[model samples]
Target: MRINVLQHTPNEGPGSIATWAELHGHALFTYHPYQFGQLPTAVETDMLIILGGPMSPNDDLPWIKAERVLIQDLLARDVPMFGACYGAQQITKALGYPVSKAPTKEVGWVPVYRQSSVIPNLPDNLNVLHWHEEMFEIPTEATWLFASAAVRNQGFVLNHRVVGLQFHVEPRQNNVREMVVNDFPYIKGSVLNQTAEDILRVTVSGKNERALFAILDYIIE
Candidate 1:
């Protein structure tokens, strides 16, 4: 299978998802919008994976708008998609919703409460990496999958093909380190936010990693 990964930044590449694609013998075509100008076409990829970023979906960047247009085009084609953090917001925006600022930043290892029965073998509470200040509401036709105390719209699934996750379940240890290093200004002592030291100290447990793969499997299958 061919998977096109839309990366918003150099640091937030497809972490565990890249490992999955490599191990499963799937082709990976990555586009770094920060460096590269254009997004991928649906005809070129069997699946689309949008990774996280520091920018909001509501940003005034030209690429951001183009990415949303690409998303809508892909959805029209019924291509399977998985989005994380800022990517989730992009999907929500493409679905005709507004991405707005949250009450506070959710930046650390946080628990996301499951809400939908769409995802099989899901835990009631999922511990994942949260690193965003913006959130989006579940789109009109999408099923709400996860939520947290800090944010109500943590995840959503549409037609079992398109999925959006507000947290970073696909992050590896190195991915976390790079994100912390690049966005250290957002770290602070708060209810949801965690310090760089604490963020680095927490190991990437196997459970969250498995959950991420499971979600990916479900979306593609």
Candidate 2:
């Protein structure tokens, strides 16, 4: 299976998802949106991944609008898609669902709990890194899979194939380092309360990667 990754920014990446994909022997393709060109071809993808970015889905940029159209078509095709953070928000908008500011921004390692355990494979508490200002409302037609203490709708699944996660499951060292650096500007005042290094030190080490791989494994297979 070919796993195509849609990256809306230079810094965000597949992280531990890459490790899992390589281990599963699936071809990984990445569409870097910042490259300034048409979206990459997806004719070969058995699954699609819409990665996280700092930009809002409501941004008026042409690329953002174009991506919305493309994502809508992908939904029409019913291709298996897994989205993270901003990507999840984008999917929410494209699906005619609502997304709004959460009561507060959730950053660093937050505890996401299994809502109902219908999947029968997830844990009661999952500590995952989050970096998003917005949150999604579970589409009326979809089933919510997880909820974090910081946000009510952490993730949702559509038809057991398309899934959206509001947290970063990619716990690779590079992902953590890059996010800390590039995301600093958005986290300015919050830094006074808690340093990025301190947050990283606490959140970076955990079994989150294994749980993330399990989600991907379940989705792709």
Candidate 3:
């Protein structure tokens, strides 16, 4: 299968998703709109993966708008899609849902409770890395999947083909470090926010990879 990824930043690339695709013998392609200002003209791939970024989907940037249009196109085509963080917000906004500021800026490793058993093998509670100030409202047509204490709309699934997660489950140790270094300014001293040292100290475990792969498999199955 041809799996296309829309990466919004250099730091936030498809980490374990690429590994999963390689293991499954699927061709993976990634487009960088932040650097090249280019995106797929149509749904040419079997699946789409949208990675996280520092920007908001509600931003007035031309590329952000274009990306949303592409997402809408994919939705219309019923293309299987997986979006993380800002990517999730983009999907929600494309679905005519509002993306607005959360009650607090949730950062670092936080626990998200599974609200539905739609994706098998997911634990009831999982601690995932989060670094988003904005939250996506669950679309009326979508099923709510997960929620965190700081954000109620942590995840949602639409038509059993599209999954949107508001946390970073695909980030490797190096990816997290690079994100901390590049987007460190966004971190503030809040109850939910974590210090750079603390966030880096925690090891990236296999549980995250398993959950991410499970979600990917569920979407494409």
- Identify the superior model by lDDT, candidate 1 or candidate 3: 3
Give the clashing pairs for model 1. Answer: none
Badly placed stretches (over 4 Å) of model 1 are none
Query: Comparing 1 and 2 by lDDT, which wins?
Result: 1
TM-score of every model? 0.95, 0.91, 0.96
Winning candidate number (lDDT): 3
lDDT of 2 by residue, 40-148 (tens): 4546567888899888887778887777777787787777788999888888999987778876777776678877554546777777777877888888888888887
As a TM-score, model 2 comes out at: 0.91
lDDT by residue (39-151, candidate 3, tens digit) is 87664768989999888887899999998898888888888999999999999999988999888888899889999998899988887899888899999989999999878
Give candidate 3 regions above 4 Å deviation: none
Candidates ranked by lDDT:
3, 1, 2
Least well predicted 10-residue stretch by lDDT in candidate 3: 185-194
Worst 10 residues of 1 by lDDT: 185-194
Candidate lDDT values, in order: 0.87, 0.77, 0.89
